[model samples]
Target: MLRTIFLSLCLSLPVLLPAASFAQQKSWSGTAEPRNEKEWIRAVQLRVNANAVNSFMTNRLAGTGRAKGVAALTVEIASDGQIKAVSIRTSSGSEEVDESLRRGVMALPQMPRFTPDMQGDSIALVIPFALHG
Candidate 1:
C-alpha cells in the first residue's frame, strides 16, 4: 500500500511542479533602460508623417475658423512595443487641439523595441502635434 501511495504521489508531482516553475518565471524579458528623448521624438515624428501630417492640421471648434496651437503628449512604451498609456502631458489649451493630439497618438502603431539610455533600458515617448502653425 505504501508503494502504491508513493507512485500516486509521484504521478501528481509533475503537474504541481509546472505551476511552481511558471510562477518563478519573470514577467518581462530584456532590461528596459532609459531611452533617448530625441529617439522617442523621432519615433513620434515618423508615426505622424507616415500618412502625412495633414490629419492634425486644423480644428474648427464652434466654427471659430481654424485655431492654431500645439498639443503635446507623453506615452509610456512597454518593452513589448505596446503603448501602455497616453496622457496629455502638455496641451495647446484648446480642447479641440488636445483631443486631436490624443487621437493621433492613439492611432500610432505598436512599437516593438527601443534603445537604452542611462536609466536602464526603459523608454518614455513624447509626441507633439502642431496645428495651424
Candidate 2:
C-alpha cells in the first residue's frame, strides 16, 4: 500500500505543478480583462514609481540639453508581482531616451499588492511615459 501511494503521488506531481502554473498565468492575464479594470489600474499604478522613473530618464538622456517624446510601454507582470517583460511599443524618437525608459521599467523597485492575484502569470498593459528633458 505504501509503495502504491508513493507511485500515485509521484505521478500526480507533474500534473499538479502544471495546473498551478496555469492557474497563475490565468490570474495575471485576467487582471487586465474587462472584468477586473479596477485591479488592473491599481496593479499598473503600483508597479512603477513615477518619481524614480522620471529621475532615471532625466539623468540617462541628458543629451541635446533635453529630450521630449512619449514612449508607449507594454509591461507583462506575473501573478506574484514579478515583471516578466517590459516592451516599448512606441519610441520617443531618441534611442537613448527610449532605452532608458525600458531600463527604468525593468528596474521598477517593486510590484505593490493592491489585491490578491492582482498580478497573474502575465499581464499586458500599455502605459505612456512622457519625457521632457
The model with the greatest TM-score is 2
In model 1, the number of clashes is: 9
Q: What are the Cα lDDT values of the candidates?
A: 0.44, 0.49
Error of 2 at 132 (Å): 1.9
Superposed by TM-score, candidate 1 places the C-alpha of residue 131 at a distance from the truth, in angstroms, of 2.3
Candidate 2 lDDT, 1-133, residue by residue in tens = 0000001110110111212222223234433432353644544543343422543435555435446766666666655456678777788787776677677667664353335534334556666655555
lDDT of 2 at 106: 76
Instruction: List ranges where model 1 is wrong by over 4 Å.
Output: 1-41, 49-54, 57-64, 115-122
Off by over 4 Å in 2: 1-40, 46-66, 113-120
**Residue pairs in clash, model 2:** 28-120, 66-133, 79-119, 79-120
> How many Å off is the CA of 59 in candidate 1?
7.6
